[model samples]
Target: MKTIKNENIFFLGVDIGSTTFKAVLLTPKGKVHHTVYTRTKPMPDAILSCSGECHKCGRCNLGAISKTIDDFLASAGIDRENVACTITTGSQIVDGLVDFIKYDAYVSEISAHVAGARHYYPDVKCILDVGGQDSKAILFDEDMQMWMSKMSGICAAGTGAFLDSVAAKLNVPVEDMDEKVNYDSKLQVSSICAVLSATSVNKFKNRYPLGDIIGAACRAQARTVMSGVGELFLDYKGPIVFQGGVASNNAVGYYLKEITNNEIIIPEFHQVMGALGAACLAAELYEKKKKKDASYEEKSVFKVGVDELQQIIESVGGTPLAKKLGGLKNKLFVHKSDNGLEKIGIPSIKQVKDAIGDVHLIREFTDIFDKVVLRKPATDKGYFKKSIAMRANITRRELFSRNRDVPMVWRNLFYPPEILNAFGARTVTLETYAAFRARNPKKLQQCFDRAASKGYSAETCSFLRVLEGDEKLPTPDFAVTTTEPCQQGERIFADLVRDYNLENKYYTLHTPYKLSEHSVEQLAGGLRESVKEMEKAFGYKLEHDKLAEACEFSNQAREYAMQANEIRFTSPPLIHGSDAILNALVFSPGWGKPEFVELQKTFRDELIERKKEVELYTNIEDTHRLVWLHLPPFYSKKLMNFIEVTNNAPIVYEEVNHVGWDILDVNDPYVSLAKRILTVGFLDPELRVKKIAASAAH
Candidate 1:
């Protein structure tokens, strides 16, 4: 029997690109530790805290960086005993032996920008990176490695500082500049640089509005940037990534979209790419350092911000990136690939390949190729296989059988995305689906190409044929389909809101079915008992049978429990099998006529009580104001009591549009008595005595 001993390991990548420095820490199996960022400022503390990782190997920094790392480690409560390795990048890396070592290894920031963008937008062949000081345009083939590269090596015109300078002079806060430009829809500022543009704006200020001037500036900046991108490639192959710090501006994003006639993807952390790249690089290096120490650990994903990491650093006194270098010396050995042999130590290529196994390090440092370690003896890379729900977008509650049974027929006719938002579900079109699908490797290159050129759809995204094989994307929690009915027996219509306890959290949605109407009606009997207290407020005595019925539904609405086609009764005239029961419970104050509105109000007030709800109607404030405008004449708080019936006018009644009213003469003999009687306001005015029939019938 042969005995084999293995060490635990990790890897890191430290990317010091043009604008920023980034550090990434990952296990040998590719689990990321943390990603940190700091601007290009020469703060020694920031540098060391960022790159001087731990005590895997010890060496002198550029003095300032060393101290910064030492102080930061002290502050982090970490002793220099745990880290196994460290890597450095950025312009400052030109210091000493460490400088010479990584200079050749140092990658351009553009690579990470391209790589990460490729991570999100794989179809990006023609790409432009517009940043703070300069902008770079790169044209690449399908794989996204640089095929051609161009730069605005000398210009402050289309940069962030340029925007900041103009915005400050315009009396706008730097952050507010983007919002202001977005709102200004008409201004045309200068594109020719700060001095010339300022002159143009100042010269035209007397005749042009400030907004128009700003709008002009916005357009000019967009034009200048597009011109730079045009210098790279004219026929714009996408997904066009608008990366770098300036990409954070929505105005810039929108403007680029209009100019290129191409969609722009401003990723969530576009401003922090340099740092993310640096972090990713650092993580790759750390994994190499760790390979010297421990043999194995399953890869894991974790979430943390900078602050949480501070606590980790503080826990170990700062040193090298290892278990413990001397005092915090880590006992792991992996050969160096190329970057870190001199400053601390490097493992030869043979030791690295033997220990950490196979990892493909593409020269640019963005694309990482890792060999899958098989626990179950399978060579399958799970990356390409994921289950995604593809018809459309579904609500969280729509997973139920009841709601699923309710036809999506209405969804096709008038699917207000607002309804999905209201239901805590999202509604996305095929375009988003296409973009999301691009992340799937099974999708062909031509599919993305055509979608980018002609726009994506089921007609486009799914055009390649083969509806035959079972190809899955990420498994979706729920799927929303369009035009097709749900699978039989799987159709759900249960309103999760009514089925769940948190009704207020879902106040915006119609009640979901959680209970049966019959079960709810049983509780209505008990609800009738509470009606005694509600009768006066409602201006009517309760009918026990009807009141009991309302209670049953209300109770069921409170408790979301039901099956497919089950009456959740979560909402009225909706969310259930029927509304006839509640509709019957509410009666109009008028005889031979029905006041649907009053019945709705009465039923709701009795059920929900005086508990103040947020925005009582969908239209909210506008609807409330309209209600006040249509207030009854009998309820007039402004009418003078002593005024006699001199001018009867038209004797208008709102009911005229519905059941309607008859006209009364301007000088009727009994006008005074009739008008005064009308003032008290009967519960159901339309059902009132025949003497005062609808006076203004339509």
Candidate 2:
């Protein structure tokens, strides 16, 4: 082991999580000198003698965290000045150590765990950390020299806190839970929800032995971790390092081993791995600082001001018009600093290029259209693929472009776009916009963080959460939503409208769960009411002729789409399922437009040509035919590509593209639109299953 030459220097790490606070002190030789671990919200009696004054003493959390660090240093026989560097991590680290304690730096829980794991097991390939509040899995890709992580949603089912709750209910100490396990027990508890699992444990207490229930609960924890973050271990090799508070449970480790059929290694200090990792980071950063390395400075992605924006534009070889546009955009969107502009950390020219490439939205749009629409034939991209990409880009351009001539209506996917088109409006479908934004992963994550900061629950749909976090969403003239498959969609849309102070412009279609004539009539009535409200608000009369024309265009597009589907079903795999699933505009806003009809015709014609070509000489074998249910992830194509290209399993059909509804009745456009909305399978579980089964049969 390498040792630091400065014997007097020491490093400290503090991890403040939702349930616990941990501190680790390390010597100059990088060995743990002392450690402290305690609950974040410790009982007053546990910290000191209780005079029952804690209720009014709002600083109990802060006191506990400070006491832990103080005691840790005192026990180590080290003074605060002797500690060369200190770093912090965990969920509560940001706010927990504000006044009393100061830290040099902070790292994410995932990064901390990875660093800690690598300290002991340098070649570690995978890690699973199940803490009190959340769980995480980190996989190291040696080939790419990178790490990828997956975390549990805002749920406590698989976490240490959940197990502790179960232990308390069973009248058993959490430490002794592993010892009381009855491995032969057949009782299985629900791993999906913590509350439901607790309820199950309570119900089973009378029927089953205590040991059997404990065993089952432990098994449930392991299963939950496997189903949640353990998803990343699918392609993992070698032993899995298990860390965090939950790793102390031998029974859970046993089940993890059994489930994965791989070795599981629990570090001696598994509970404080995050703190250890932080300490390791502190020592490394301190060494860099000693050498006066510029890398020691903290780096973060920031919203650029005018000057930095200009530099970025010039770095990317921007045109004069582009530079002017960039400057205008920066002034409008980026925050201006009254102080001197902060220097951006440009590590290398490539990084500068990547930064500019990631955020140059207009440039990206121009490049995409130029490649897919203008240079389609030259690039060897199929006509259908080109058409899909072009249609998506066109919709994005229309929604994003500032067109003062038309009202921009924000709508849920369930609302028909044809009506908005008739009213001379551009539409922004929430899901489609989210998908478009997802093209830039870095920006999308910023949106997620922003949403979290705004108190949006992590359990909210990622699509809607993306919208909540998005500061760049175009202000809508009005908004509409449906109370059907997704109530969250309605809630979020309503919140957005409230935020924009456009209460009167907001509209919602109350869709019943079951489809019937009365329900359809009720929906039609709602649609008519919404149309009237829009007409009054925008000062434009609803013309029946324009609506009828839009519906006719939709009908023509529907015919072409049906033909395309038939060709896809009967013919060989010419189009990838990934590409087909992205034909979202068919279900999105512009179905009523002539361009959509042209897109559909081109799609159908391309499929026909591919079918003829395959029939002539190509002998493509039918491998695994998959029917994709629900929506594929919009953020990345890795999973889809792995299945289709790597595994040779073609996604034969997708439920989203299944044209199940009938052609719109142009004469009775409102009622027809209502009926079409009602027929959507997603609104009804039975209908969705039937559709899935039918698609599978093909």
Q: Each model's RMSD to truth, in Å?
A: 27.7, 17.5
Candidate 1: lDDT of 348?
Answer: 28
Maximum-TM-score candidate: 2
TM for candidate 2 is: 0.49
Best by lDDT: 2
Give TM-scores for every candidate, taking all chains together and pairing residue i with residue i.
Answer: 0.35, 0.49
Instruction: For candidate 2, give the lDDT.
Output: 0.76
- Model 2 — which ten-residue stretch has the worst lDDT? 293-302
Judge candidate 1 at residue 64 and give its lDDT. Answer: 33
Backbone clash tally (model 1): 131
